[model samples]
Target: MKLATYLDGSRDGQLVVVSRDLSQAHFANGIATRLQQVLDDWAFMAPQLEELSISLNHGRCRHAFAFNPAQCMAPLPRAYGWTVPEDGGRRASDALLGPHAPLRLLADPVPCAARYAVLHGDVPRGIDALSARDAIRLLLLAAESPTHTAFAPVAVSPDELGAAWQNGRVMLPVLAMHNGRREGGTDKPEPGADFGRLLSDLAHPRALRAGSLVGATTAVLVPAMAAGDAVRFEVKDEAGHSIFGAIEQDVVLEGTATE
Candidate 1:
């Protein structure tokens, strides 16, 4: 079933089960209140959620409203743990933000492709996938480094749009710009390690799992960014329809890049 966190006119929005066509929604009341809450108890909550989806689809419920992608938040507002393989960092940042992100890459964000994944649950049972539906998320951050990023306001999950890992790649449809150069492409990264591997990785020294990951893309490209540059990204469905909507990355204090 499709799920999202929408503005209920508050800071932490209400959790909702959106329609497949992206037209309507029914609030996930009682059963669950937030996306993280659902993720935290997927095995217990999913069955109940499935029933709610059925009821909403049958028009047997009230408290429903017109679904608005513009009023959505990242499926996971703040990821439990966010990791980008060696070179994919720059591209992930650029595509996630914008080409003008002002990334000061100590190393070229090319040559070495990487893996991306989201882990939730626990070290032993890390469930991974960005979203059951391909989603659009934005990260806006300003730090001492030109490349630091943070989560933005708008994020959308339209249900069942996320690409399944094929052969060994997860496609991240991307638009990038660098010094007036514009390009479009995909990023393929293994979502995350298997359960056993995840446990092993987390078992390493100083390896306390921070948050649960949801999903990720690979082959992200790194673009040169500046202080005033803007970074925007969107995730579309197989038919190229906006699922996550539009995320415009803004740079307030684009820092300088270092060696």
Candidate 2:
């Protein structure tokens, strides 16, 4: 079942269940009004919301409306912490760090962190004392192409989640960038990794972390950005089932001194 957050003219948009075909939507009016609330209590709320989704598909539920990607927000606008694995220059450029060869911003915020972080969770292994919501959110952005970094929906059962880590094999589909840049174009898309490999890569020490950037990627896409450029990020399916909808603001270099 696909879940999303739509704009209700509020800071935290209202939660809703989107049909598989993306032709319809059912409001989560009674069942946790916010997406984070739903994520916080996903174990108990998902099934209930799924039931409502079934009803909506059958025309039994009320207030079903046409779904629109334009009026959506990131599944989790801000995450507790952020971790971005080293790109190795396979899917991105190494020159993004403006003449700095060593690259000291791994532990700090990068342009991508400020613009794209979408999915959030308790911890790398979900052992944290905080609320347990481990499903990875795919932060979709308005890019020139698809990065294969979007989140694929799956059942969040303990056994299923654990299976993703066993023997370095995962049933989960990891979106990966592929091929090569086509004359100043973005990279292509393909299955990059299973759950085990992705988790391991994300935990790598050389990774970058930000308070707001939440999602994981094999390579950093937004290696660089300027002060005036408005680079937006979002992740949804072909049918527009927004996992993390999109970043609202454009990329702004807040007071980086001119030198």
- Best candidate according to TM-score: 1
The candidate that wins on lDDT is 1
Q: Stretches of candidate 1 above 4 Å error?
A: 8-12, 54-61, 85-119, 125-163, 167-169, 175-211, 214-218, 254-259
Model 2: per-residue Cα lDDT over 75-141, one tens digit each: 4333343334333322331122111112122222343332122343323442321222233432322
How does each model score on lDDT? 0.44, 0.41
Candidate 1 lDDT over residue span 1-259, tens digit each: 5666665655446778766555678888778887667666667886787788777767766877787656665445545544442323312322222112233344433221122343344332232332211222111111112344423222322224455433223344444433344444444422433323333434443333333442333323433444445545444456765443434444444244422
Instruction: Tell me each candidate's TM-score.
Output: 0.57, 0.50
lDDT for 209 (candidate 1): 36
